[model samples]
Target: MATLDIKLKKANKVYKEGELVKGVICVDAGRSEIAHQGITLIMDGSVNLQLSAKSVGLFEAFYSSLKPLQLINYSLDIAKPGKLPSGRTEIPFEVPLKPKGNKELYETYHGVFVNIQYSLKAEMKRPLLAKDLQKSCEFIVEYSNKDAKEKALSKPVQFTISPETLTNVKEKQNVPKFKVKGKLETAVLCITKPLKGELVVEQCDTPIKSIEIQLVRVETCGCAEGYAKDATEIQNIQIADGNVCRGIPIPIFMIFPRLFTCPTLSTNNFKVDFEINIVIVFQDNHLVTENFPIKLTRF
Candidate 1:
């Protein structure tokens, strides 16, 4: 017999731009377990296409061909994932996002290798009980480079906001309020220990390495939606060993575009969901996105 299930390493049912998702895909193989080949782990997501171009040379009149193209997909494959005996295994993984335009591969004749918009599906191909147990997840590849700007913000301060979703609407048409608003706060706790994460790059042609525990800040972030939002800010934050630079997470709070709505409809109350956005900056410049939700509400 065969079975399949998804076990997320963190409470990560959602994600933000440039944020890394952590977890394991667990698969159990029942009778007919023998002749069982190892397992494969796959990760993928569908994304919206975003392309931009610049004219550095000719083509000022014919239509510039020097354009930029980026794909909104991140995934990895574990050839022989970890096994848990009895034909069951939980494979761990880490995927880095090259958010829109962070960098792209191009050609002179093809313009930009634009990724229009495609669905992403990362799964495992296993043989067990005629049913397949796999770990699959989805994420967004935003057109925002806001994550890098806040890198200078120092830390040790654990920062996050409440209310994951922020929504407003017009009264008569049940339309979500176009310009909703909310507040977020940061905290400085006396940490009895430190948070850690690993960076793996096998293409380096060298051995993997790790650094000591020297950090500056602990940041948290989330998102919001509306035609417009409140001029947001963070305060009262504290840190342990390092300084709290901006005292908050990057993009502070991002905007998720409206996926469903009719211009004729209006309402003031709706759910604006945001999972906690977190970052732990290590002395070596290793950024770790923590598990937290700064979900908020505006009524």
Candidate 2:
């Protein structure tokens, strides 16, 4: 059987915008010499919207409600085909992966309800009655730059949660009345950096049992669906198996590992968010929980 393989020249598969994708298209003519049209290379990026809606009935058919938006669509004519020898031939090519418009390219993401994907295709066109031979490969795109880092540093820190300022949303069953205040060094932080903060339990209706600090990542599917999961936890931080009096402050710090977390990102279909979960357990089995959102950026 005949074969066509598209191999990226560089070993690195990860790329950013505005970079050139260099590769070679190798064609292995199976048995006899072949004649064809020109070779075409197409590169594009798109965001596919996926929805997790329940089926109407057991026998009802389902269709996708989301549509894919193209971020980049470019084609290159690698060569005007002539005649190829019976053996193997290689053609080198390079094409810019930049998007067409001023809109920024989104980072590659694979979620339950959304996916941002990119692919490179090599097509070997043949004459009439013969099928066109095609091959494709996928690559990753990350958004990173010096300017984004500078902006992240200069961005004001808005990480703070005060029980006194707690709104009507804090009402929950078996939750004790308490006033806790805390602040972080910065609102925007790199994944490599440690999240530093201080928590003070000013007053409480009951004795404090334990304190737990948790790192949570919230992945929302557009404005319709939202999911929250704990990425990490600092267990028994303070007042463990003990009680804390009023007017006591405890230091809080945790380094967000890159393994289970990603930089905060948002698109029209989905988003990822990082936050700090402050859970204060009372001796009476009551709970006081507060959460503060923090922005995470890539290094």
Which structure among the candidates has the greatest TM-score?
A: 2
Residue lDDT tens for model 1, 63-129: 3322222344444555443334567766565555444455331111101211222223435454565
What is the C-alpha lDDT profile of model 2 across 108-199, one tens digit per residue? 66544456788899998998988888999887777668425334573544333445554544554345567776667777888668877676
Every model's TM-score: 0.32, 0.60
What's every prediction's RMSD, in angstroms? 21.4, 7.0
Worst 10 residues of 2 by lDDT: 55-64
| Local accuracy by lDDT, each model | 0.31, 0.69
Best by lDDT: 2
Cα-based lDDT at residue 14, candidate 1: 41
Q: Model 2: residues >4 Å from true position, as ranges?
A: 54-66, 146-187, 191-262, 267-270, 275-292
